[model samples]
Target: MPYTPRKAYVVGVGMTKFDKPRGERDYPELGLEASVKALIDAGLTYDQVETAAVGYCYGDSTCGQRALYQLGMTGIPIVNVNNNCSTGSSAFAFAANAIQSGQAECALALGFEKMAAGSLGSAWDDRAQPMEGTMTQLFEIEGDKEYEVDDFGPFAARIFGAAGQEYCEKYGATWDHIAAISAKNHKHSVKNPYAQFRISPSSADVAKARKITREVTLPMCSPTSDGGAAAIVCSEEFVKAHKLEDRAIELAGLGIATDSVKLYEDKSRIELAGADMSRRAAQKAYQQAGITAKDVQVIELHDCFAPNELVTYPALGLCAEGEAHKIVENGDNTYGGKWVVNPSGGLESKGHPLGATGIGMIAYMALQLRNEAGDLQVKDVKHALTHNIGLGGSCVVTVLKKAPFYKEGSHCKDRFGYDFAREERRMTQEELDKVRSKHFSDYLPPSVPESKL
Candidate 1:
């Protein structure tokens, strides 16, 4: 039997304010907040969602269910996912595949993380480490180079900084050129209400910041934070049935690429860090969407580190080969440029909550496509792109735009009794009541803001 593909649309999207990990809230509260808000924004109820894919990296198995149980034990399938930093997009891709494959009419994709403060490190010590191969290869490359191999810091900074160093060594882009990309994202973060760091920094500020590595500085890296984000993905058929014509944003094309042999061929550090995976993913997504880089007006790129963003410009075909620094120099990566990249401030400023970052990217991109992003909105955007990646390694590139039936006055103006896009608000009890299942739970968290209120 042949399986015909159907269109998947992100009809609703929501997220919690990406905040420093203060331990004030748990994963359950964060996940539920984003889920309830998403359901309400879609004008749908929990019972209506046929299945779900939830992502969290710092939790035990079924932690997803623990969070979802508050919505009611609907007995719907909830597949838990963990894919390093790309966890949220992995969940999103799961839901999109579910809809497109006709396995479910509607599904939920949710991601949240309650991370430890400071630099991220591995939790498991007994098992064979997943990143061992990449780490070993990174050290080997450094051993052969003229640079000091012992001026190290966090594992993430070292590997990514190596890639940035390579870009400069190979293409004549200086460290300041790499820093400029970080500075640009910091500037963009000011308009994002959900960003963790709203303060802007100049390129010099980035260049001179406390060095994490020779090629990386403090401000150039994403922070460990606590947050959650979610989206409701459904088929076009379901949209018509639910009278959601005015708001649905089509997931026109989606491509997921995993590690190829290039990841460890003793080759470029850029490929070792999986930038080539992003390139391949973008290629597949663009082919599916029937569009080129020229057609995309806005982007929510996975700038996990400043160097990655610069490498990604060429990977995603945003600029000529090794000319990513040119994108920064020409002012083409921000508003009024050729493409407004990382208008959500990107992972660098927006705060990377492991599992939540990818989904947060989707939520922000949805706001832009709906024209409800307010201060951060890109003008006349038709196509928006989101790129999320994880090391050891996978990358998901998604292309989205307004649905054919989309109109100017979307339900966002009144959905959830306010603009879910422009106004960042937690779900009130009244609002939660509108989306939760008729069959419910009394699992109370005394620490949640809404619950405390």
Candidate 2:
């Protein structure tokens, strides 16, 4: 008999506000905020979690233990993950696997990052860098070309920037098209309270912004951010036992893929930037979920750079190859078009906090499926997809849908009137008190005016 995987659902999700590195709270505080909020959303407590997977890129060994210690050290098995930018999604995948495999009834996936206040770089120069192969491929492609490497911006900018240049040369894309992509994401961020940069810019403004690399401007790149996000994964039995059908979001399909031979062998710089990995992962996820890109109503893809977003459109099967630029020009990637891509402002505007980004996408998708995204809500959303990538390299694509068993007259509806936004606020104080009282006895709830409540 073929192996059939058990089902898993996301019962709760949350995140701390994304901010510039060293702007505010520590990793422990950020992690605690998101974890507590997720538990509250799920109507669960820390003790109920049987296992956990925590993700981070720059941190000491066992940082997961230190960060999660704020929630309460229940002695659950904690797995540490670091898969570059895809760290958070990798953590989420691990938690989901635990639930699907019957290893845990309830599992937690938490991701946080406290980055340095500049472009990302290697922590150690003593040994071979992980991106050596990718850099070698890039050099091979640029042989005889005299390109000035930007000392101030991230090396990733050049990689994706070159890919954008390649697309323009191979197809008919232009700098204006890439600027439009950036403008769209920035505009989308205006409504997202949790985003790091909420200032929407015009396409012209984006094109004129400080240049980071070849045709890549400042607004085109994701800023280094400090934040955290979390999701609570549970089995069908657990959701039923807790009577959480109304709030549950089914993890319909998840796919993860790494670099293929194409990365080194192909002449396409886009392929080296993990486009093939994204394509493979998306294909697997769509196959597992038995749905096509046409069925997806919303998407939160890794727009680490605007150029990457353009390249990813075709990789995710959103459009035909070599026609991704056409979709942008046709308004098919935004609202009232084919799909609302990156309604959470994406990594470009929402801010990529490395490990937090993947789970953050999950949080956004879950809210959209629950119809609780507030101003960022898309219309009549049925299924949502998320794409998160880490170069050197891995990609994870997940499909989510509203739980089938959920009914109109459920607990969420009866108690909160199905207003997820309001429910999130009303429950925050109560849950904070519950958590603090169990751990920190002297903790006091922040006072809010009755009018706001």
Candidate 3:
């Protein structure tokens, strides 16, 4: 027997432009802006929102309440959610689930972050604690020495570097190829009015750019940003009563999973814990949406670092176990690939405002489904997916399907199937030309030659 589908629809979405502002707005102000805009987009008033789920990684106490106060006091319940990088998506999941569970007919999910908090390290890890000894010594080994880079950076670096090198060896991908993915995001971002870094650089430019610190560069990394995004989610009955079926973007699936924070804890775990969670999430999403991976026309993966995409590509089954890099080199992850990834420029260039990113991804995908993405819109986006990974590899995957998918109960089959090599083989020079044409020469490092491919 076939399973009955759970129906939850996203009716309204809103986001502020990501800017590297000279002065930051308070979380309340940012949240207020997003909240008002979301209601406006949904064609509803504050009274219609049965509950509010607000996501923020770093904010003052009572931040959500303070923000809601800016709007007239509504006695409705307000749920505050914090899950590091995945906070936004987690909040969205909660709102959708509440609607599905019959807890509420209409709910709001808001994700807001401000640069006043600083980068992820200073924002979450608290470097000053180690210096003050309030926290354990940086890398002290039972009254011994301190570990230089400590846990997050070194652990992430080892996993990213090792996996990247392995992918390079297995599929003939080069550092140039990896760099190209960053270039692709930046190039696409140049067209996005709301992206923080709206400038493009060639692969050679990124490869030879001066390092800000280690392999990271001003261009290669997303800027610290102050921004917010919000979504209004409601039940199918509410949508129909309000005559909002056209605006309703259905939720097909949601998955959340975690992995060990320590890099060396599980040697056999080739995929991050979040990857496994995302895989399971995808399986459920496919079953619910009645579509396979190939049916997805666009995707937005958690690209906090370029390497995150490398690990995620295979885990999401876009490629084989260790060949995501090849997808980049062949330009299959670009504008007109089998499935376009990160048309919103992704975290690498679009900006990673932590709590805002998950909602931001969904907003962009919804725009594509509605054919309102302008230049970034892929052709015929029937099904789209957003995969966001948080600190220590906490993962959340959400599946979205366009209208008319529910009534028919049709299972969309994979046109390309699970053949990674076939996809790689189809990569052509013409595909590379489109990327090259969008390149901006100013972003290149002085040392690198431009003509060499």
Best by lDDT: 1
Clashes of each: 0, 0, 1
Which sections of candidate 3 miss by over 4 Å? 1-5, 122-163, 169-171, 212-216, 260-274, 405-453
Q: Rank the candidates by lDDT, best first.
A: 1, 2, 3
| TM-score of each candidate structure, all chains considered together | 0.96, 0.92, 0.79
Better of 1 and 2 by TM-score: 1
Considering TM-score, where higher is better, how would the candidates rank from best to worst?
A: 1, 2, 3
Tens digits of per-residue lDDT, candidate 1, 173-256, equal 999988899999999999888889999999998999999877789999999999999999999889989988777999988989
lDDT on C-alpha atoms for all candidate structures: 0.88, 0.86, 0.67
- Which of candidates 2 and 3 is the stronger one according to lDDT? 2
Residues 307-345 of candidate 2 have per-residue lDDT tens digits of 999999999999889999999999988889889999888
